[model samples]
Every structure is written in structure tokens, then in C-alpha cells.
Target chain A: SQQGEEDPQALSIQEGENATMNCSYKTSINNLQWYRQNSGRGLVHLILIRSNEREKHSGRLRVTLDTSKKSSSLLITASRAADTASYFCATDETYFQGAQKLVFGQGTRLTINP
Target chain B: EAGVTQFPSHSVIEKGQTVTLRCDPISGHDNLYWYRRVMGKEIKFLLHFVKESKQDESGMPNNRFLAERTGGTYSTLKVQPAELEDSGVYFCASSPPGVTDTQYFGPGTRLTVL
Candidate 1:
């Protein structure tokens, strides 16, 4: 069973607008990280927020985590056409042999139209 | 520094054939991981390795899938008698020791089982 599920599986906006994606998970997590994938290749790490933290910012990316709600959101301000890609939320949970491993959500596909 | 790398960017094989996918993590990264995204599904963790030792493999689907990391530097995932449901992107990632949450991903191998 997938641990996380992303909402608004697809989103489209103008280049200057902001894009927000939401993710909800089922289990307690050590941290939640967002990633972007372009052309279905490697996934680029965007940002990470620890369970103890509420919000974080890096450049134009903002991430918010709510452990109480078991949810997270990622906001990309001042979106650009180049920002078009698939975004995924990964949650780190306890796995076999006591290793904390990440489980990802179904990605939200965001398209920034120029 | 060079990021993680995966071999045979794409592989097409028959149902009973064998396919081997390789991943080389960044230098000095001893923690390796394997994941995959099936058709229209979320990414799922396959396993984790810590310095040539199998740390976690709870997500591995079955015995037909074998993952090995030699010398804690590079890893390989072999699928014997690949099934149609196995066609998807196989991704490998590595994180430096003690940084288990932030992972660097490799360009995934697109496995197409015909």
C-alpha cells in the first residue's frame, strides 16, 4: 500500500502565478521531502522538512508540514515555464532492519504555461 | 562532483528474460537505495544498503527481484522472468552516511517487459 497520496494530480498555471501541491500520508514520519522529476529521469531534491519543523523556505520554494494532520504542502512562487515537471512527496518511515526508508506519493504534475 | 548514475537508460525484454540494472552512487556515499514507480503508481522503496550490508528490504515485491551492493559503492538490481507489471522506471539513490533522509537519485532505467 502506498503511504502518501497527492491531491490535484494535475495543475496548470501561468508563468508568473504560484503553484501549490498537497500530499497526505498515512504513517508517522521522521521527515518529509519534496522532489521534482523532469522527463522521467532522475528526481531532483527540492527541499526537506523535518517532523519537528512547521515550515521551511529555500529560494522560491516553500514547504509546510503538519504532523497533526499528517499532511504537507509545497508552494512554488513566481513560477516559470521551466518549472513544469512532476512533483512528489516522500515520507521517511521505519523499515526492515531498522533502516528509515522513504516512501513516495503519486506525483502532482504541474505545468507552467508561458 | 558527479551524481548517481544508472546504466542502460532503457531496457526492453521478453517476459521470461532477465534484466540487470546498475547504479553508481556519488563517491563517499555508503548508503544506497533502490526504488521503482509502476504504471501510474507512486514511487516505492525497494531496499537499502549500508556499506555492503543489506539494511532494509521490506518493500521488495518478491524473491524474483534481487538487489546487491558490492563494496558499498555500486548496486545492481536483477529481475528474472520479468513480468508485464514490472515495466516501469527503476531508480537508485544514495545518501551520505548519517544523512539517511536526503538522497541523490540516478537517471532511472526504464524497463519494458514485453
Candidate 2:
């Protein structure tokens, strides 16, 4: 089973507008990370928020995590045409007795209209 | 430094044939991971390798899929007698072991099993 599910599977917005994507996971997670993928390319790490932390920011990207609700949201401000890509939320949970591993969501396809 | 690299970028093979996908993580990265995503499905972890040792392989579907990292640098995933279900983009990620939740990815190898 997939660990995380992202809502609003597709989103379209103006280049300078803000975009928000939500993700809900099933189990308790050690941490959650967001990544961006351009067409036919691999994902690039954006930001990571641990369960002990509530929010994190990196440049134009902001990530919020609510461990109690097993949910997280990623906000990309000042979006650009280069930001048009698939965003994915991946979860790290305990497994193999104690080791932690990451499982990914289906991804949210965001289109920044230029 | 360089990022993760994978080749050949795309491969098409008949069912029952064998295919090998290779990944070279960034220099000095010891942790390597393999993931796959079928059409309309979320990306799933296939395995993880830490410096030539198999750290976790719980996500591998079956014996037909085998992953190996030699000299703790480049990794290879071989699918023997490939099935139609094997068609998808295969992604390879690498992290410098102690970095909390940071994984860099390769461009990915698109495998087409016909």
C-alpha cells in the first residue's frame, strides 16, 4: 500500500501565483519530504520537515507538517514556468523492526501557465 | 560535483528478454536506492543499498528483479525474462548516508516491455 496520497492531483495557475498541494499519509512518519520532477527526469529534493518540527522554508518553497493528522502541505510561492512539474510527497516510516524507509505518493501535477 | 546519472535513457525490449539498467550516484555518496513507477501508479521503492551491502529490499516485487551496487558506487538493476508489468520508469536515488531525509535522484531509465 502507498504511504501517502496527495490531493488536487492536478493544479493550474498563473506563473506568479502561489500553488498549494496537500498530502495525507496512513502511518506515523519519522519525516516527510517534498520533491519536484521535470518531465522525463528524476526528482529533485525541495525541503524536508521532521515529525518534531512543524514548518520549514527554503527560498520560495514552504512546507508544513502536522504529525497528529498525518498530513502535510507544500506551498510554492512566486511560481515560474520552470516550476511546472510533478510534485511528490514521500514519507519515512519505521520498518524492519527499527529502520526507517521512504514511500512516495502518487504526485500532484502542477502546471504554471506563462 | 556531479549528480546521479542513469543510462541508457530509454530501453525497449520484448517480454521474456532481459534488461539491465545502471545508475551512478554522486561521488562520495554511499547510500543508493531504486524505485519504479508504472503508469497511473505511485512510485514505489524497490530496494536500498548502503556501501555494497543490501540495507533493505522489502519493496522488490519478485526474484526476477535483482539490484547490485559494486564498489559502493554504481548500481545495476537487472530484470530477467521481463514481463509486461515491468514497463515503467525506473529511478535511482542516492544519499550521503547520514543526511537526514536528503536523497538526490538520477534522470531515470524508461523501460518498455512489449
Candidate 3:
């Protein structure tokens, strides 16, 4: 069974607008990370938030994690056409001995229209 | 500073045939992982290796799928007697030791079992 599930499987917005995607997980996690995949490309690391951290920001990306709700969100500000891609949220569950493997969620497809 | 790399970006084979996918993680990265995404489904973890030792393989679907990392450098995933349900994108990821939160991914191998 998949540990995380992303909400709003698809989202489309103007290039200058902001895009937000949400994810919910079933288990306790050591950390949560967001990744992006361009068409025909590999997944790219975006942002990571530890279970003890509430929010983090990197360039135009902001990520928030709520352990109480077992949910997370990724917000991309001032989206660009190049931001069009699939975003996935992955969880490193604490149950694993070393927490090496990551369980991923069905990605949210975001389209930034120019 | 070469990133993770996977060989044979795309593969097409008939059912019951064997296919081998290779992944070379970033140098010095001991944590190697394998994941796959069936069409329209979430990407699922297949296994993990730390320095040539299998750390966690709880997500492996079955015995037909074999993953190995020789010398703790590069890894390979072999699927024997591939089935139609096995067609999907196979991804390889690696994280630096002690850094389980972020993983670097390689261009995935798209396996199409006909």
C-alpha cells in the first residue's frame, strides 16, 4: 500500500500565479521530501522537511509539514512555464531500521500556462 | 560531480524475457534505492542497499525481481520472466550516508513488456 497520497491530482495556473499541492500520509515519518519530474526526465529533489521542522523555503519553493495531521504541502510562488511538471511527495518512515527507503505518493501534475 | 545515471533509458521486451537495468549512483553515496511506477500509479520502493548489503527489501513485489549492488558502487535490477504488469518506469536513487532525507534520482528506465 502507498504511504502517501497527493491531493488535486492535476492543477493548472497562470505563469505568474502560485501553485500549491497537498499530500497526506498514513504512517509516522522521519522526514518528508518533495520532488519534481519534467517530461521524459528524472525526478529532481525540491525540498525536504524533517518531522521536527514545520516549514522550509528554497528559492521560490515553500514546504510545510504537520506531523499532527500527517500531511504536507508544497507551494511554488510566481510559477513559470518551466515549472510545469509532476510533483511527488515521499516519506521516510521511522519504522524502518535505518529509514533508507522512501515511500512515494502518486504525483500531482501541475501545468503553468504562459 | 556526475549525478546518478541509469543505462538504457528505454527498454522494450516480450513477456517471459529477461531485462536488466543498471544504475550508477553519485560517487561516495552508499545508500542506493530502486523504485518503480506502474502506469498511472504511485512510484513504489523496490529495495535499498547500503554498501553492498541489502538494508531493506520489504517493498519488493516478488522473487522474480532481483537487485544487487556489487562493491557498494553501482547497482543492477534484473527482472526475469517479465510480465505485462511489470511494464513501467524504473527509477534509481541514491543518498549520501547519514542523509536519508534527500535522494538524488537518475533518468529512469522505461520498461515496456509486450
Candidate 4:
């Protein structure tokens, strides 16, 4: 079973537009990270926001986490054609052995048009 | 400076056959993980290896699947008598096992069982 679920299974937008994807989790998380997968090959780490933090930013990517609601959102501003890919949100939990384990969401497929 | 590497980008085999996939993690990374995503499903964790020991393998499905890391540098996952349900993309990831570090991923190996 997966802990996180991302909304908007598919999205299409023009270049320079903004794309937003939302993720909701079931349990408490130590940290939530976002990744980008191009053509289902490899995944690239995008950004990670700890539970204590509310928001984080890197380049054109902005992530917001609301522990109260157990949900997070990724906002990509000024999107480009290169940004077209599948976006996934992963949540990390601490096991009894004190190791961090990651659980991923279903992912959102975004298409950027030029 | 190199990313994680995986061999046999894609494979297609008939049911009841065996398949082996290899992953070479980045040097000096102590934490290694294996995950897979079936068609129309989320990525699920298969196991975790810290150094040469198997720290967690709760996600392994059955006895037909086996994973090993000899010297903690590289790992191999072998499936004997593969089934149709085992067709999916297998991903390998590694991290430094510390605070505020990200997990690096490899370009997964896609396996298709006919």
C-alpha cells in the first residue's frame, strides 16, 4: 500500500505556465521529497521539505507541506517544455530500527507544450 | 561524481524464466534500496541494505525473489521462475544515511514477462 496519493493524474499546459500537483498522505512523515521521472527511466531528486518546515523553494520549484492536513503541494512556476515529465511525491517514515523508509505516490504526468 | 548505474536497460522473457538485474551504487554510500513499479501502480519498496547487511526486507513478495550485496558496493536482484505479475520497472537507489541527505537513483531496469 502507498502512503501518498497525488491529484490531477494528467495535466497539460503551455510553456511559461504554472503547474501544480497535490499529494496527500495517510501517516506522519519525517520528510517529504519530490522527484521527476522522464519517460519512466530514472528519477531525479527535485526537493525535500522536512515536517517542521512549511515551505521550500529551489529555482522554479516551490513545495508546501501542511502537516495538519497531511498533505503537500508542488508548484512549478514558469514551466518549460523540459519540465514535462512525471512528478512523484515520496514520504519518509522512521521504523523501529531508526532507519528512514520512503513511500511513493501514484505520480502526476505533466505535459508542457511549446 | 557519477550517478548510480544499472545494467540491461530492458528485458523481455517468457514466464517461468529467470532474470537477474544489477545495480552499482555510488562509492561511499552506505544505504542502498530497491524499489519497483508495476503497470498503473505506485512504486513499492522491496528491500534495504546498510553496508553488507540486510537491514530491512519486509517488502519482498516471495521466496522466488532474492537480493544480495556482497561488499556493500554493488547489489544484484535475481528472480527465478518469474511470473507475469513480476513485470515492471525495478529501480535502485542509494544515500549517505545521514541527516539532510537525498537518495540518488539509477536509470531503472524494465522487465517484461510474457
Indicate whether candidate 1 or candidate 4 has the larger DockQ: 1
Chain A of candidate 3 gets a TM-score of 0.94
Q: How close is candidate 1 to the true structure, as a TM-score?
A: 0.95
User: Is candidate 2 or 4 superior in DockQ?
Assistant: 2
**Who is ahead in lDDT, 2 or 3?**
3
lDDT tens digits by residue: candidate 1, B1-114:
999999989999999899999999999998999999999689999999998999888889999999998877899999997999999999999989877878999989999999
Q: Of 3 and 4, which scores higher on DockQ?
A: 3
Q: Compared with the true structure, what per-residue lDDT tens digits does model 3 show for residues B1-114?
A: 999999889999999999999999999998999999999699998888888998888888999999999899999999998999999999999989877668899999999999
* Weakest lDDT window of 10 consecutive positions for candidate 3 chain A: A92-101
Which structure among the candidates has the greatest DockQ?
1
Which residue pairs does candidate 2 place in steric collision? Answer: none
- lDDT at A5 for candidate 2? 92
- Per-residue lDDT tens digits of candidate 4, residues A16-73? 9999999999988888999999995798999999999999999999999999999999
Q: What is the TM-score of chain A in candidate 1?
A: 0.94
> For candidate 1, lDDT tens digit of each residue in A1-114?
438788889999999999999999988888999999987668999999999999999999999999999999999999999899999999988755556788899899999999
The worst-scoring run of ten residues by lDDT in candidate 1 chain B lies at: B94-103
Q: What share of the true interface contacts does each candidate keep?
A: 0.93, 0.68, 0.83, 0.63
TM-score of chain A of each: 0.94, 0.94, 0.94, 0.95
Model 3 ranges off by over 4 Å: none
Q: Write the number of the candidate with greater TM-score, choosing between 1 and 4.
A: 4
Give a tens-digit lDDT track for model 4, residues B1-114: 998999889999999999999999888888888999999588888888988899889989999999999988899999998999999999999988563137899999999999
User: What's the residue-level lDDT of B59 in candidate 1?
Assistant: 80
Please give each candidate's TM-score. 0.95, 0.94, 0.95, 0.96
Judged by lDDT against the true structure, how good is candidate 4? 0.90
